[model samples]
Target: MVDYKLELIILPVSDVAAAKAFYDKLDWRLDVDIQGEGGFRAVHYTPTGSHASIIISNGLTDAAPGSTRGTYLVVDDIEVARADIASRGIEITEVFHEAQGGIPSVNKEGRTPGLAPERASYFSFAIFSDPEGNEFILQEITTRLPGRV
Candidate 1:
């Protein structure tokens, strides 16, 4: 048997410096920034308490800038997290929840204003984007689903 862990996500950006600055404003930890020969460069960032990391670099991926979407960041409290981030000067969408009989989506197909009724975990979310328009979703999850941990 073997164990595998998700490690890194590569984000394509037109300007590495702008992307780096955006993540810095979010207060995510900047793990590393390195420049290599032949004009190679990579800037790594990790959200607080996250096991995985994201790398914004040149030539590591072929995806276009702002193509990344629906990347979810789990939080214990969506409101608090949203407020904290909004205070950081980032524009985030108001907290929204999946309506009954509706699946969660990056689009606002079945989303309702404010938090989920009674504040259920994994049902509420807020959205924001980086300078490159890379979309990120912040989801509330106080308790993990079975086998998630």
Candidate 2:
């Protein structure tokens, strides 16, 4: 078994500058910005509380465009959060129910579907892909224990 805390998601891009601009527009804060070191350039960003880190890099040994790499950002309110993100021009991915305890559950198509709903866990989430086509998700958990579905 492996104990994991912090995570790093490295995304390769053809144009690092363009990728940085797109993420910036989303109001995603940028971390250390290093350009031109040993033929590698990188820019890092992490959501609040250091849930996960996204690294935009160039001149990497591995990784290609449209490579799927992402994380889940938990949210409190899925509808409100999805609306806010939609206003920002990001699209949600899927809304489905995970069965537990012989009960059926539902969540918004993108940012609201609570993962493992039967567990009564809060995990309202939304999925979005970067400009380079790498997909990631934001999740928010509100309540614990099953609610009236």
Candidate 3:
């Protein structure tokens, strides 16, 4: 069997500089920034403790800016992560757990207030978005499901 790994994700942004600034504020590691001929430019950033990195560039895809959503970043502690991000001046949604149905709803309506009562991994989450409206969810996951690792 072939091994597959997710290394990069391309994010569309209306302004490259603005996006760069936003990610910088989040304290993500700036991996590279390259400019090429014909108005080409690429910027790569990796969040702290994340193996996968995100690429922001021009002339790479036709996707509209801010159209990307639901990207997730897993953490061991949702409250600490949320507070850290919020301390950086980023606005974050309140922490929420999955509703009684065992699946997160499509929007805020499906979320119940506060953390998961059982402290279940992958059950708690908080949401935030970049300046371009690219949404990201921070999920608390202290353990992985069987074979996930």
Candidate 4:
């Protein structure tokens, strides 16, 4: 049995410099930036405390900018994580939890007014997007369910 790890995600952006600057503002570690022949360039950044990193590159994929949505970044504390990103001048949607029926909402619809009243793990979330509108959700998860490592 081989263990597989997801180490990187490719983010599509129209302006590489602007996207690089935006991620840089988040204080993510800049791992790579290389310019190759024929206008090819690749940039890599890793968020703080994240084992997974993100790549923003030219000539990488055919995916459209801002097309990726609902990508999640799990956090131990939703408030702190939200505040940190907000303080960096990013506009984050209000913290929200799923409606009482246990079905998670899609995008902005069906979300309850505020944080999970019970502070339940994996229930609270905050939303934000990059310059090109690639959506990312910050989900609070203090404890993991079975088999989740």
- Which ranges of candidate 1 are over 4 A from the true structure? 37-39, 101-103
User: What lDDT would candidate 3 get against the real structure?
Assistant: 0.87
Off by over 4 Å in 2: 1-3, 37-39, 94-125, 143-149
**Model 3 steric clash pairs:** none
Give each prediction's root-mean-square deviation over alpha carbons.
Answer: 1.6, 6.3, 1.5, 1.6
Ranking by lDDT: 3, 1, 4, 2
**TM-score, one value per model:** 0.92, 0.67, 0.93, 0.92
Stretches off by above 4 angstroms in model 4 are 101-104
TM-score, structure 4 vs. true? 0.92
For candidate 4, the per-residue lDDT at 24 reads: 87
The candidate, 1 or 2, that scores higher on lDDT is 1
For residues 1-149, what per-residue lDDT tens digits would candidate 2 score against the true structure?
99666677777887788888877767777878898856667889876556678788877537786585545666666556667677777666543333332222234322234444643444334577778787766555566456522
- Clash list (residue pairs), candidate 4: none
How many steric overlaps are in each model, in order? 0, 11, 0, 0
On residues 1-149, what C-alpha lDDT tens digit does candidate 1 reach at each position?
Answer: 99899899888888888878888998888899998887678899998999999998876888998889888899999999999999999999999888872346755778899988878878888999888888889999888879988
lDDT of each residue in 28-145, candidate 3, tens digit only: 9999998889877789999899899998877578999877788899999999999999999999989998787354557677798889888888889889998988889899989999
- Global lDDT scores for all candidate models: 0.86, 0.63, 0.87, 0.85
